[model samples]
Target: MPAKKPFALRLDEKMMQAVEKWAADEFRSTNGQIEWLIHEALKKAGRLKDTKEGGRMKDEG
Candidate 1:
């Protein structure tokens, strides 16, 4: 596991509640859920450098 850095996020109450609910449903802490979301976004944008497999973005031909 890599080291995690802590930071502050100022989400409004509604947004925070939604995130908390999502985290609970997923059996993850709110921080873990947010980390997963960011990682997925970066992977979708071709910004991830360490993909274990190279053919993930290929068409299913």
Candidate 2:
């Protein structure tokens, strides 16, 4: 697994409430929703790498 990084985020009350509701509807935690949002945005912007063989992980002997 890749190392996880920590950062601070600020959201307005209205946006935060919307995200919280959406997260519940999707059955994902708030943090997960935020991560998903970021990932999707990056992918939409063509900044995410394509899934390929190199992206797969192999078990070590």
Candidate 3:
């Protein structure tokens, strides 16, 4: 596992609401959904690293 970084995130009211709804729909915590969204965005930008424990790169497809 990689070292985790801590930082602050500021979301506008509407954006936060949308994320909350999406998180509920996906049965994931809001923080988890945010992490997933960040990971996905990074992957799309070719900035995400691959993991050995079955975590594949998004672009591998």
Candidate 4:
């Protein structure tokens, strides 16, 4: 595993609220949920290369 990198992500109020609710319902941190969404999208497009998951974890881990 590599060291986790940190950066700022700006979201509109409405979008942020939706993501927050979804994350809560799924018992995942907002960051984790977002990562999972991105990972799934990449997989659907055949862009993920990492065996461990290209840029995200498979679970809410």
Error of 3 at 52 (Å): 5.9
Better of 2 and 4 by TM-score: 2
Q: What ranges in model 1 sit over 4 Å off?
A: 53-61
List TM-score per model, in order: 0.73, 0.79, 0.73, 0.74
After TM-score superposition, the amount by which residue 35's alpha carbon in candidate 1 deviates from its true location, in angstroms, is 0.8
- Model 1 lDDT, residue 58, Cα: 33
- In model 3, pairs of residues that clash are none
Worst 10 residues of 4 by lDDT: 52-61
lDDT of 1 by residue, 5-41 (tens): 8889899999989988999999999998988888778
Range of the 10 consecutive residues with the lowest summed lDDT in candidate 1: 52-61
RMSD (Cα, Å) of model 2: 5.4
Residue ranges of candidate 3 with Cα displaced over 4 Å: 50-61
The alpha-carbon deviation from the true structure for residue 5 of candidate 2, after best TM-score superposition, in angstroms, is 0.5
TM-score of 2: 0.79
Q: How well does model 4 score by local distance difference test?
A: 0.83
Q: Where is model 4 more than 4 Å wrong at Cα?
A: 50-61
lDDT of 4 by residue, 1-61 (tens): 7698888999999999999999999999999999888877887887866555666645324
